[model samples]
Target: MSEKSRFEYVREGAKTRDGVDIVYYEPNLPPGSKAERRMVRLVAFMLLLSGLAALIFVAAYIWWPFTDFPATDGWEYKPGNSFMKGYTPILGLSLGLALFLIGFAVLIWGKKLMPHEIALQDRHDGGSDPEERKLTGNTLAFIGEEFGLGRRPLLKVALLAPAAGLGAAALAVPVGMLIKDPHNPDELFRTGWSPEANGGKMVRMMREDMTPIRPEDVSIGGQITAFPMTADGLGATNKYADSPVLLIRLRPKDAEFLRSQLHHHPVNVGGMYGDLVAYSKICTHAGCPASLYEQQTNLLLCPCHQSQFKITENARPVFGPASRRLPMLPIELDGEGYLVARNDFNGVPVGPAFWEKPAA
Candidate 1:
């Protein structure tokens, strides 16, 4: 057969017409040559090293210790075995070495024993010719007939079962997430701020750890952050999300004017606690934690979008994207004489107004 015919018939699909090809060669050595024996031994050594790395990878997987995070009291996410610390790095090194050794072995075998050659083949546009297509079609048809799928329905079903099982395995992963309710889009909107939380009782402000605030923590002409002190206390993180209050100690004269000026202005629960008022720390613009207070100017600034709020009158937005006033956190002293929130914001959504609600 001609060289072209040999390539088409025997080595069909061996190489593309881009002058690239893969060849396998058996070693050839002159008799009694010590160097030839040494080369074979070196190749065997590399193969053994690759096998040893693979074994070590399996051993590490079964025995190595690993920790995902600094341990939090009861949260142990990983198995606490001794080898865990080095588990991942050892596995990576072993796998990488195994692959490198295999590649290096093949390159050495090629350089030491394989004969090299350069051959040319034809390249054509579009696709294979009609004759080649006919040949491929006949080959596929021969294989189909040999399997006898049309005559053996049981064999066809058996072959399809594994493929269907694989497809089902892929779909099963997302099934758990589909169990969530599709209808509750506004679940996050409802909170302890709902009227039912208080039974018309006051919503007292507390700290992140559920301790009520004292007027002393907030210096005169200064501000402090506070959260709702609900029955759930510090455990109620969600309530605290919307309950941040900027407790401002106003000048007595300004505080007196503010009480009369703003409708539903905050008041001191007792005789000595005058000029102390708490307003929602949540910026009316985009609900940033508006904690940056300018003591002299009495302006609260949200770093996120520069929404400036004037605290002297009420926590009213004086500049930027914020149009509404910061929601006032009503305050009163609890039994221990510590400041606490009187109630949630009176029916006002503390953040930016929705399309349904008018701008302040």
Candidate 2:
């Protein structure tokens, strides 16, 4: 037959269902051609692979070890923490592959098995006629009547209870955070270095290995990261992020300078332990570790934002975005000569100040 006649034949052979016309642009395959069979297998294989990937995603999400495992410096991939390190990447790959394969399978099925054709439909620009609107409203009313809600008041009340409860539950999901306090405001102002945290006695400063640091342990013009040596014997790890303090043994000239600065600002001297001063390692601006010490310049720098704190001037912010000084941990030598916190930070909260923090 001619191309025009064949096209006409195909269009005429189209069917309609539920007021919608269904057109097919291609004829059915004769028995089973190898090419058509291969296409079918390829599409099925893609769909099966997609399903397998989805199942793997679900399994990994549920069974993978995602807990904080022992690793050097918190996040490095060591043999002990390899599973934890790979958990997130595996989840992303599995889920992404599942979604990608499903879409690919649909594309292949359409291109290989289905015919390409344009659908035509009559379009009306304005709102539906009054008759159609009336019919739609009547249909909705009939559905409501079929529910028998008006006639059965008790059933309607029961249904309303679930709807109201569900709505409240949905609202609570977002509103719950505002209502709840995740961390205590009072606790935020305190740390493991506080005297109360160590059985109402002085808390000793220790190294990362939990050994108590004596004044002699730190050399002049050098800084050592210290933590509160609590009764638990877990100095740094016990309090983790909040308890680290920079113990700087200043040179005689710098110490004299700091003493001079203290005379003018007595509150800044509250945490000074003579020549060996202790300050919070956390930055006041963004809470990045302000631990990069420049012994020559007497400056403590936060690597994250280049915030400079002059160690001689009460760890005061000398440059960058930091607006406040690093809160000093009140230090003194105990009876045994171990460097210890004399008291909690003199009323000033450490780290980044929030709206709840009182104005300095």
Instruction: Judging by lDDT against the true structure, name the best candidate.
Output: 2
176-283, model 2: which lDDT tens digit per residue?
332333343355567788776688899998887778889889898888999888776656773456779889999998988888887554666656777888889989
lDDT of each residue in 267-318, candidate 1, tens digit only = 3222124788777777877888888988778788999999998776566778
Deviating ranges (above 4 Å) for candidate 1? 1-201, 264-273
TM-score of each: 0.43, 0.51
RMSD of each predicted structure: 14.8, 13.8
TM-score of candidate 1 versus the correct structure, residues matched by position: 0.43
Name the lDDT of candidate 2: 0.67
Candidate 2 wrong stretches, greater than 4 Å: 1-185, 238-240, 357-360
